[model samples]
Target chain A: MSSWEPDSDFVFHMPTKVLYGPGSHREIRAEMADLACDRAVIVTDRGLRENTDLPARIQKALGATCVGVFDDVEPDSRFEIVDAGAAFAAKLGADCLVSVGGGSSMDTTKAISIVMTNGGSIREHLAVHALTGPQTPHIAVPTTAGTGSEVTNVALIKDEAARTKFFVLDNQIFPRTAILDPTLTTGLPAGLTASTAMDAMTHAIEAITSICRNSMSESFAVQAIGMINGAIRRAVEAPEDILARGTLLSAATMAGAAFCNAMVGVVHAVAHALGGVCSVPHGIANSIMLPHAIHFNAVTDAEAYAPVVATLGIKASSPLAAAQMAAARLTELAASCGLQTKLSQVGVNRRQFQEIADKAMADGAVLNNCRPVAGPEEIVALLDAAF
Target chain B: MAVVFPTAEWVAEFKKQIDEKPDYKEGGKGWREGVIVLIINAKPQVGIDADFNIYLDLHEGQCREARVCSDEEVGDHPFVIRGEYDRWKLVVLDQLEPVKAMMQGKLKLTGDLPTIVRNIDGAKTLVKCATYVETVFIDE
Candidate 1:
């Protein structure tokens, strides 16, 4: 094989079976039958359960298969909740897990599967490839357009006692299936719609330029970026536009799949650190740091961003110029969507910058960055720039 | 080159550089973990007859100890990173990120992952300081 094919020797893992489009949630019955799962536990957050009809809709779709509902998952889901979710699922004898809502809900479901099967604190299972053995099957029904948690093998479950977010990455934890229904997202306000799409865009850009990127991952990232660029504005403006929301949903999933293989870079590292350390919403944190990270990577791997520049419709004469244009366009897009462009705008104090930088340097995503980071000092400088 | 990596002189140089470099000190001040053992696997062409361990006790921004020791001597180390000689060479020469190398499976990391993640700057600083050693590579 040609040297251009990095993935020829590499493994590409995409185990999550996706059922997308309008009303795909109805396919849960068939999926359950396919997985030979008789009982399912629906995982969701209280906010989504209270605010949306998603829980009732999911129950109606599941019919007799839905044996239980664990609606206690919080945003940035904690280990205790996952433990409790696992217990609840076990009590109900749930053979399958159904996640409804966004990243937190889906992640909670993933964590539950781990604890249910592994029988330990989630902390013990916090390293790369820490998990082994079969997991109770999971089906994700994403209610938001970001996180792509539906397709990824990463679960960022927070440990409340440690005051740190621990990520669990294992192919075993990937949901067996995902249901993407854009109608569930129409109720998402303009702000959330914008922030989520920005998050998806961050995933795409980071994946596209990630050092571990391959042809397949790049194709997914590029397509995701293009779709997000084309449909984000409409999704935010019209909120109820099924086509636009559908496009953003597809983009988010594609970006998720891309980053799952290619992995993300500094943007995710910083954003994840923000989520862990400061309780910042992942989407907002990603949107705030995305442009600065793009600029940082562009300084060294400017040519890597040609696809992003072209996808964003930025005209430029050189690689650096293209990178700059892409970054500028991203900033403009975020601003137009009323998302905060500065970290300071989102209540992250200057005092916490050093700690956040330290965490970012340690994040798994930092390893996948195209341009090798010197250490926390460089990250602190980046944080300061974003500030 | 000032020293050849995987040698006693290189470990000493690494400790000295960590002490002398203000950036390393500042970046690693929050790292309180102790005892990191670098297990370099055997490479026949490079004169490595057997796998050896480099023990480092990093305490709140200071390298309390840095030395080459036998595998049996790597006692009570909280973090132990094991990898092939070539991968270690790449890391010491600044061609690869230590964390990246671990993720790519070129390096095997065993320790408290959260604390390590929290102290990632220290990890990077440790690797970055090695790059400044002006070391000689056996392959080169």
Candidate 2:
């Protein structure tokens, strides 16, 4: 076992009320009433708005409280989109937001709420702990079973000007309620299902090994790891299986809660960089980098990965061996799910490695990494290996 | 003789120690953000009647200046961290982590939090430098 000591002091706070079931999303009107919000706007993407009937169903469920829908959110959430969303909601006199779809939609809604309440550009509120009070009431209805953005206090918004993604971490952005309805996630394609499930897996692993992790966060992370390990393959294979979908959704939320409090580590840092630099989808980038990050972190925090090995049902002779086996098991799992295993497969070449490394070195998530990163050279090395 | 906390001598010693530590130099490389002011709120019962503001002009892995200054003199810095005298004592004694203390509301920080968070190793190194100063707490 690792000789790491428990933190001297830590705080655990998860206030978002979660409602889960087959059609729990229909309760959004009641949630709006509870928050004392009258005019609600549905924040989503154009694809879902045009193609799926989910938005129409939500609008019907919300009844007269749904004033309008803002469906301009792009695949990678951007500052301009958040500003436009805020303008749309403000113009509609929306007192509450109901975000529908994946992480981008939820994160855009969070940024819109910030801009509406704080009365400033989204760029002004990009820093951590920037909010002084609670934002506009928000109810997050996650259509995907990954990202856990509904329950997290973080919002990853891209800056088109800088060609980089900035993290917004504030306690007030936690959605007033999170509606996890398996019916919403059952339509996800097999590829997205596998990638997002691996995203949750990465969050769980990074949370457990993060330097700031405490007993409570560790509990959540460990549970999430076990749940994702058991449900990922089944969910990917049987996309219409409600039970598997529900388990994965709940596990994603649990992982979200864990990483939000304890914070994520190197995998997230590197993945965020890749998402910004190369436009790799966040979940896919995380899927490609998770095993590499585990191996890199194991050099300094082998004992921390022992719990992960046990949770993955792998028997090992020692902590370091357990960590290595855990990394190998993750690679096998991703391959079994048909996730891309290399940066090269995702169009990231050696020429872009240095820039990604520099961004990763500056990312806030790097501070919580188990090993102290010396410089960009170390990150470049990891990129080369993963490439 | 041990240097008293919140004194000019202590700040000087901290600067000297930070400059000497190879770990801080290596960890703090490329930290060109700006000045950071640490304000220790006073407790009259502990013989501290006024808030103590320690100005640290940190740039590119070096402490260009370290001194005790008034609040009015600390103009336009990118970061300011304020906490109770007792809380800072615990931090200096290595009983509490600085980032955790900030998250828990024991310390109130004003500035770009991401910059501070991104360079946490440098912050920890600064705290380590403080510990090297043989401290005589005012209350004690």
TM-score of each: 0.79, 0.89
- Candidate 2 lDDT over A67-118, as tens digits, reads 9999999977889899999999999999999999999999999999999998
lDDT of 2 at A102: 93
In terms of TM-score, how similar is model 2 to the real structure? 0.89
| Candidate 1 overall lDDT versus native | 0.83
Query: What stretches of model 2 exceed 4 Å from their correct place?
Result: A1-4, B1-29, B39-54, B61-75, B82-86, B100-114, B117-121, B132-140
Q: Residue B97 of model 1: what lDDT?
A: 75
In candidate 1, position A175 carries an lDDT of 92
State the DockQ of every prediction. 0.17, 0.30
Clashing pairs in 2: none
Please write out the lDDT profile of model 1 over residues B46-136, one tens digit for every residue: 8887886898888888888888988777656657888888889878877777765555455766665556766777888888888778788
Identify the leading candidate in terms of TM-score: 2
Off by over 4 Å in 1: A1-9, B1-111, B114-140
- Clashes per candidate (backbone, < 3 Å): 0, 0
lDDT of the candidates, in the order given: 0.83, 0.86
